[model samples]
Target: MKKKILYWGILSAAVLVVIAASYATWNRLDPNYTCARCHEISTACAKWEQSVHADVTCTDCHGTALESFNSMSEKLNMVYKHFTTKKTFEDIHLTEKQSLALANRCAECHQAEQASWMSGAHSTTYKDIFMDVEHNKMERPYWDCFRCHGMFYDGDIDDLMAMEGGPEDWHIKDASQMDKPAITCLACHQVHHEQPRGMNYKDMDETSRGALAQKAKYPSTALYMRADKRHMPADKLLKEQIFAGDSLVAEIKDANTLLCMQCHAPGTNHQLGSEDDKTTIGDFKDMSCITCHDPHSNQLKTSHRNVHKKLFSTLSK
Candidate 1:
């Protein structure tokens, strides 16, 4: 009986050792090479290798290992499916939940930008935007509403609210989504794209540094238009027509303001200051939307002191 007990104890210890070793191996294989093992994602892996975030691990931005219990199970399931099924992998896209998870990862590197985004109107929650009694009562909710309000949401506007038109009974379909942000950091920025290489601004001449800062391209700056379910590059957004009365006053062709115009401009009518638009006129006619409004924080930088101070402080830093 003593010999039998000793043998079982040794067997259990060996099982535990095997389990530990397997877990370690699983973790070790989470790097980019393991992801590239699947040919479908090899292109993405290659792009990531060339990106500014090349140093960042594949799992850091993509997986929710610590947050979700099903993350490991999901990966295992994918592997199983890949082996057993004949279906070829077309593309891998981030779900709303996965995209939301990236907010924390982004905050890890860009705390100041994250803080500014969180504090702004752009960070408004689904409940704040959709379930507002005053706003809903005034105007009817439609499918186009999600174009700006809940851009990251995978489902249609009908899936969110009950009624369409005036004085209708309304309630959120998913109570859990009430507090979740409709527009997240990924709504405006593309993580996979490369950025301008960091220059020694301090060592460079003031003119050279200023020129570099002005000309440096923000390749990652994009507007995630829910209507098409694709990211429109900030520089390539469609030019919007601004109207004063009957005549077209200006075509907002500025690349910098293009992303902002996606939501801030007038609706289909394309009239300035219509449908929650704050398009400026008079002395501010030539200025871009970003002239007064801080893009991330949405704070008014109208005053010369405030504008120049922020500019000089950024340059000095």
Candidate 2:
């Protein structure tokens, strides 16, 4: 019995030592050292500092592996593993896993953007558009947070362009992570303590700027459908307008359509409007989405609430 107890005690001691060593090494291992040194890329350190993203440390986003960090040899092995991994149908080949990891990291700083984005009309439609239920048959999954937002390192282009081809399903194929560069966090946030322009809707005035703002927010939906020159359901709406020559709505609407409708064109249902009222805006056909909702600070506050059009209803008629 004493012999068995002695043997059990020896095993327990060995396990404790391993645990202590692992914890100590983990606490001491530094991610900047592992990633920057083994990769021999000073930009990882340099850009990281200069970027507004400098506020976040490497490990904060990348998720640390202390065992690998404790040994320079192990760290180098991990780098090799990442480069050597095979491609998959998921996102860009070496990216999907790391992308997922970085998304959790990004949430640390972008919780507010995430909340608003979740509530926005864009997010709601993206789920259906990307899923392709009728065609994919395979029921391909949609991109989660990282597919669009995460940063692609400089050399990852080759991995992205290699995916399968089809216009509707092509972005699904591999893309050079390098080509799909991440718009920096500061692209959306005021990270350097700069005061933001605030809600665009709240800033409108009766001056030219506000008039231009009107043109920007509510662009001509009918003229855009007609100008597509492609056959569409909304083309007839443009014909119903009161002008035989160039209608003022058509002229103004076309200009604003060129700017806002570049991506938000007529064919796709933006899901903001109904079948009858969706494209109808009377004289304000020459506007864009940014007119009503400030791209930067449009929250559901009374300050951002729009009342300009309601006040001008008589003139609109």
Please state every model's RMSD to the true fold in angstroms.
Answer: 7.0, 13.9
Q: Least lDDT summed over 10 consecutive residues: which range in candidate 2?
A: 224-233
Q: Model 2: C-alpha RMSD to truth?
A: 13.9
Give the per-residue lDDT digits (tens) of candidate 1, residues 1-317: 99999999999999999986875576567456477777767766776666657767776676634446778776677778777866433345567877787887888876766788888888899888888888888876778887877777878777887764444457688889889988888788777655443443334564654353234255446777675566666777777777756778767666656677777767667766567555555455546655566667887754733543443344335
Highest-scoring model, TM-score = 1
The Cα error of candidate 2 at residue 79, in Å, is 3.8
Model 2 lDDT on a 0 to 1 scale: 0.39
How well does candidate 2 score on lDDT at residue 163?
A: 26
List runs of model 2 lying over 4 Å from the truth.
1-32, 66-77, 82-94, 125-127, 131-317
State TM-scores per candidate: 0.76, 0.38
Tens-place lDDT per residue, model 2, 1-317, is: 99999999999999999987885565455646544553444444554554434545555655455535444454466568657865322222223334334444555665654555556543332224333446345543333222333322323323332325553544423323333324322222222121123323223343633354344233212221112211121212222222212342233233332333333333333322312122325444534445555432334345435443442344345
TM-score of 2: 0.38
Q: How many residue pairs clash in model 2?
A: 18
